[model samples]
Target: MSQLTGPVPDTVFPRLGWVDDLVVPALREAVGALPAAEARVAGYHRGWTEADGAPVESTPRRGKAVRPALTLLSALAVGGSARDALPGAVAVELVHDFTLLHDDVIDGDALRRHRPAAWSVFGTSAAVLAGDALLVAAMRAVSDVPCRSAAAVAELVGALMELVEGQSADVAFEEAPAVSVPQYLGMAGGKTGSLMGCACALGGVLAGADGERVGGLREFGRRLGVAFQCADDVLGIWGRSRRSGKPVGSDLAARKKSLPVVAALAGEGAAARELRALYASPHPLAEQEVVVARELVERAGGREAAEEEARRQLAEALRALSYARPSADVYRQLQEIAWAMVRRDA
Candidate 1:
């Protein structure tokens, strides 16, 4: 129950060092292998270089390497060398970046990590093409793994399909008159949890773990991923816009029907009624309405409900992790990282 409210701990997971040392380097090499134009766009999007190919230090460009870290950590937890899992780790990270590049365009987000989004900086078409390149690259990386390559590719393909479905649901929900909490949770799991489960499963499979252990690792990641999305919903409304690198109430302004918003609308209360009326308006919400929408969601106990769900999911993740029976050190690190993810301030 340690607070994860401030600066990132030096070690997000025990194998984070491996991600930094191996997975990141491998990603760079993969991007470098792209065609010149595509490589430039991918490199810029990754925060490794500027749009003009100038070397610059933009830490914001390098996202928190959680997925790759999970891949490597799960490998080590299963008594496999991180080196053997490098390709899978690289594939997972590339898939994440591919989704981010396309998602920014889909969400009409102009900024990411306090900088212009890839689409804004490099043009939408270039960003999209770059994303496509990354997706292909991810598949190639996984398919090239020496052991269990076919299974790894299958896992990634399944996750990517779920990602598309989830994103479609998210977009459709914006126009739908009502969205159930169950539907919202399902979308959350699809959008955020699927890849996480795949990442862990790939690691365990690559490590030659038994099916039961692999299933346990995947369950751990899946629950943690859902918790991660719930925490993100809280941040979308209440977190500092500057710190989180987005506008305040960004989701509210767009009528995104995120978890909290959907929950608030589902509640049977005066505040829920008021919230529905506000959402039903044809026009996009103005700044003042955005502020009021946040308050209404809170008043309807949406924030509290979402926070409780996050904690509950995290606990489930921990239980699943325990089922995996990782070494003591690995278990402690994974537990800490899971808590940090759900309890983060931004």
Candidate 2:
């Protein structure tokens, strides 16, 4: 429940400052190439109104393109040029944005990346359509990659299936009586980890990397994704109250079945009873209950356990990288990115 401030800790890899200059432009270009497609779909939602209205400025504004960057970097690590992997990178990013568009609608989230969510502004129906548009666009973009192998297409499809399954599990957990730690991990793996795994795997496959080496990259991404979700869970509860742009213990308020809460419940101690009572209560959690929830998570060792779990996943990610056969420098940079995922503040 402690607040995190200042720079994230450096653990396994040195930060590479060059990714901004090297990778981002490629991503932009890949996305830019689809303007006609995005515009066509935008028409479906608003029709002539959209065309007559001031253009939705193509501002270089979006959430951190971390997933796409991972795809590009993974390809580079395997000796492929970023340009060569642009299609795969764009495909993954489109899929991610599509998920977010739908997720915000389902979760009733009003804001995303500091802006009104697509659903909030466009209405749920339009938002759903936009999400579908993005998915179709993603497939089209990837399909345009000349000479793409069948195996690569299959991997992308598999990732999409896993993503849907994970999202379904997440929604189901909200109403379920109890969620075990393993179940939560599996959900995170399916929702977030699968896409990341595909990102790395696509990179390797495009570069024609050996199967064993590609498998290693996929493992690296999977572990990193687990660690990333663990860190996010910690932040959802304990990060700066204002900067998080949500109430403290917002997860508790929403009755989210996160790792720490599930762990505290499983312990069958005072914390568990208190949580069950609070959750069962008709009244909203007052400030005092928030404090109590924090205490329960702490006293039950949930925070420490979650952190340890993140570290374990991070170690697994590093181990996978060690076997990936990347050039020493590329391997170092990729490892750095993985460490950054665990250590990021937001």
Candidate 3:
């Protein structure tokens, strides 16, 4: 087993290679049961196949598969075998992909994972249908888990609802005159945190963990997810294109009300005033305006504030890990994972 005591993995399989052997094949098994068209879209979105469903030359899978890995790790943290949590892992990964598919459609983002998004290649309707199919498949996978797995199914459903609500709020925020930091955090918690919490909780439920510890794992994942989002918000405007797979200021170009933007607009300074005026226009930011917006965000201290929030949430996540009462090694492993979530360079 590869050690799980570092930052997030860059490759499809982390140095923690255990997930490669277990999670990938099981995810394939779950997705393999879908109809041909949905499967093709799913496969392509997952980087498992070309847009036509033909196999791609072997390369690192586009995503880090972090949610699935967290599910399996939660199983281990709860003193259960990773194999026993395969269904949960598969369900989490499917749900994540489902969200990404719809998110691209909603955001009108043409790229994903450094390539054309599924909706960009396939029709938007087809991508939406594929996302719907994945949702069904995810629920089916959860239900297949042995004994008392009903809880897992319910939790996944709850997360999906929460995710939808967050996404809805996000859409609304774009047109709203002002959005508070608290509102942004709440949206981030739901949009990103809910499923992450569900990933850990489902693992615990499937592994037969008790309610208290399972709940603890849920909170831990929830906090970590917020941290992850904070990092992502920072990256959205400032991250390197080669590492992030998206051009710098992509979020700015879209006029997204991301955390940093909201935080910056909260400022009382000249830069913040200028930024608010720039963002008030209904149209997307022009290319040069994106550059100006980046500068305004930094000048208004949004970047530092967002980065600090990420650190704060990371600490909170570690503190919450106490409730899970994992073994020393497991505790340390989770600590590493929490750090990675907030500290990712991409």
Candidate 4:
């Protein structure tokens, strides 16, 4: 087993060599099954290939791979081998990539993982098409898993439907006058939680764990997913570009109604009015305006409210973990990862 103490490791599966050493290879192979141009775009988006199709000089951090880690770890928690869950892990990762590719296009994000987004380098059509290809590829990745592969695919597709609904709601929110806290949380749960829950549940399903245990794992992942999003919202407004690999206050610049921003708008008095007006402005925010927006979010108690909610969700996640009945070592590792995710600055 890998060390779980000290600072957070470089990868979500720092202890599980197979996640990086084995699953990644299989994922790449699965991605390679796409058409040549689509495969090139996918590889480049995954930090494996240059724009021109040459291999990258060194490995780059594609993403946290938290969903895949949860899938493999949940399998181990239920007394199954990590290898047994590799197909599920790969499927979840592909689904995640598909969402990101389309989200980048929708949000007009120029940067991802400290490089140009696929939509920015390639055309929007290529990015969207590649995303569609990934969804199809993800289904193929899990189609041949023994025993419960068909059921797993059904679960993933259901989660994808939920994700689509959440994204649609998010887009609609841009034009709405107000969004309640519950509504925002519900959207976050759908957009971020559904797939995470499915990832954990797949482990238990594949391991033949009891329904109660699978449900517990699913709930644990759901709560953790909310906590992750809350922390991410915090980072979006105030985190350093160097650490987050995006411009400071990028959400503000885009006029995005993130958790903290929404909470701030709901506050009383002059600050809220100022924030509302700033958001309503037609032009992109200037750098100074972005700084002001960040300050306004902090001063209006939005940051505090969002942080407190994250802590609450984290506590709830730990409560769910108790019912999960994970092994002693696995429990420790899960706790560490949970804290790292909920408490992270970037």
Best-matching candidate per lDDT: 3
> Over 4 Å off in model 3, which ranges?
1-13, 61-63, 242-244
Write candidate 2's Cα lDDT for 1-346 as tens digits.
1322224664332233343455445444544454554543343222222333454455432334666667777888888887677777777877877888788889887766545565666678777776787778678767777776576788789899998999999999988888888998899899888999888888887777888888988888888888888777777777653222444477766767777777777777777787777666655567777778878787877777777778888899889977778888888777777766766664
Task: Please give, for residues 237-293, the per-residue lDDT of candidate 4 as tens digits.
Answer: 765432335666788888888888888899996888889888888777899999898
Error of 3 at 70 (Å): 0.8
Tens digits of per-residue lDDT for model 1, 1-346: 3332334554454445546778777999999998898899888877778879987664432336888878877888888877888888899889988998899999889987677888998899999999999999999999998778988888889889988988898888877889998898888888999889888877887887888888889999888999989888888888764333677678899888878888899999999999989989988889999999999999997887888788888999889987777889888877877877887675
Q: Per-residue CA lDDT of candidate 3, range 40-134, in tens? A: 99999988899877898988743367788788888888998888888998998899999999999998888888889999999899899999999
Model 1: lDDT to the true structure: 0.83
lDDT of 2 at 324: 75
Taken over the whole model, the C-alpha lDDT of each candidate is 0.83, 0.71, 0.84, 0.81
Model 4 poorest 10 in a row by lDDT: 1-10
Decoy 3 TM-score against native: 0.94
* TM-scores for every predicted model: 0.94, 0.84, 0.94, 0.93
Residue 303 lDDT (model 4): 85
- Clashing residue pair totals per candidate (backbone < 3 A): 0, 0, 0, 0
- Stronger candidate by lDDT (2 vs 3): 3
Model 2 misplaced regions, further than 4 Å: 1-6, 9-63, 241-248, 282-288
